[model samples]
Target: MVKSADGVIVSGVKDVDDFFEHERTFLLEYHNRVKDASAKSDRMTRSHKSAADDYNRIGSSLYALGTQDSTDICKFFLKVSELFDKTRKIEARVSADEDLKLSDLLKYYLRESQAAKVRLGCEELMMGILVCILKQCRAVWLGSQRLVDWGRRNEDLLYRRSRSLVDYENANKALDKARAKNKDVLQAETSQQLCCQKFEKISESAKQELIDFKTRRVAAFRKNLVELAELELKHAKTGFLCVAPAILELTQ
Candidate 1:
């Protein structure tokens, strides 16, 4: 994908140049921006945009609090950004692959994303992220092995390489380097190396409270769907349909 008319991809970075390193410039720029953005709580989010955005902000805030040193916070945030970016790219690649169901990819990314946040969030968020990630990791590990086998069986055209594949490669290289320095150093668990604490399963009370609020929100959810259905059905009905004002509130 990085070939120009002269069979050369133009380098985006100006400072230094490496011909063989196609992804180096883009990766460096991405890392630098995320590193800077993640460090400042001021720029985290003045206004929460979406659920993912909210988690990202909270993750950054937690990074600031959980560590004693500035270097620790910066490193943790960079690790999470790497995970998040890789997860996004993997989701896109899996979606575009004709051999894979997009649902599986989305589910994998969702769990990975949440897991990254958990390694970086609070008690409740961490527990949720851990549980989901544990399950997803097992499935993904198996799936990737099978995918490789399938690729060999099918002439290697089924699925594109996942973005996490690159992250995994980088992580393995780091592990190898560390191992070379000190043979006694055990490589940490791939999933929980950065996870500070083991999150216990959440309490029933918290689950119930969240569920009750969501159940109430569904009353509003149905109103929008029902309104559209009614509009279609009542095109022939001339009389005024009397709907209660309390129900009208749900429409909005």
Candidate 2:
């Protein structure tokens, strides 16, 4: 564990630890699922090329978001197609993720996608939703920073607090003063305990926020499901209608 100057314990992580181990798992899993879905579409002899391209774009955006690299984010999300492909399955699963226990925010987001009411074209919904979510998160992050600052200030107060130990030449006087000093010491100890408890509560609150985020994400996903379903349905109908032409051409 790494302790900050003020004794805040920051846990140790592994080398590949992008501080997103939990998130990475979810991303990789989702990526795999999307790839699987695309592969299935390929089996249907749909426009695999377009889907594959969208898949790459989604990966690129995921990489950028994970690294906080706008360039990568731009590559993935700049195109409407890429955005939709990436976001589609995710929103579909958002409700599930919210209800699950997660060690990382990314994982939480990933799990939420599972609870999606409509299992449909996740690709189309990825961009618009994320663009909005990111903007909202920026505002919330700013607010959190202020709260963190307040916590730090409260800790700072502890560092400057002084203890006074007075000694009287007379034994009786010394005993009396010691009793009073002991009370002061007890007060300090109580304050420290209170701070510890407050810190713990704050940590728990952060955890709850993550859970709540996953939950709220489901609502957004519900709104997006219709479009996803339409896309999937369109793809299915298009493929069905096109099969006869391809079969006839192949028979030649």
Candidate 3:
């Protein structure tokens, strides 16, 4: 056993083995979580693309509608001019120049006023529709952007988790190698019992060195695990505090 920086005794074999097993379990769970997060990220990316496509389509439609409205307005204005010219011709034929009849003037004014009102109403209705569509497009754009940001944050977390797993695996392999060496030393010492008494002191010193080395290894591995845990916690906090708020802002 070896003492850790925190003054806690760390076992060389049993405790280390148990710790590694726990880490393996955690790594498995973490890997699954990463996979899930990746799938979600992919979905979010696809959604963003779809939203962008929709925005483009809607923008094109709005442009076409605006152009059509302008063309229709121009046509209506020309038709109104034609009506006025016809009215003048009729007035000339009816009275040659006697101050245009009050009835004729009233008729012309009423027709012009009605046509203007209809054109204004149509334009207003179209504008309202365009405004509604634009608002919807803005909301969709915001949602897609939020998803992309969230997904990127998740991917960063996943990368950290993966690195931690790799560290754990490397630590486990080192421990395994140390254990094998210790086993070889034990077997050789046992087989050389003919001179055991003469070499008793040396054997004891060797045993102590082996124990110290194993203890140090265990303590170092435990420290690594602790650091990994802290890093994971930091990532979790960042996601909640930073990414979550950004997502909320987008929603708003």
> Estimated TM-score per prediction?
0.18, 0.31, 0.26
lDDT per residue (tens digit) for residues 66-85 in model 3? 45655765544444443333
Global lDDT of model 2? 0.37
Tell me the deviation in Å of residue 150 in model 2: 19
> For each candidate, C-alpha RMSD in Å?
27.0, 18.5, 32.3
* Backbone-clash count (model 1): 0
Clashes of each: 0, 18, 0
The Cα RMSD of model 3 versus the native structure comes to 32.3
Clash-forming residue pairs, model 3: none
Q: Sort by TM-score, best first: what order? A: 2, 3, 1
By TM-score, the best candidate is 2
What TM value does model 1 have? 0.18
C-alpha lDDT of residue 160 in model 1: 11
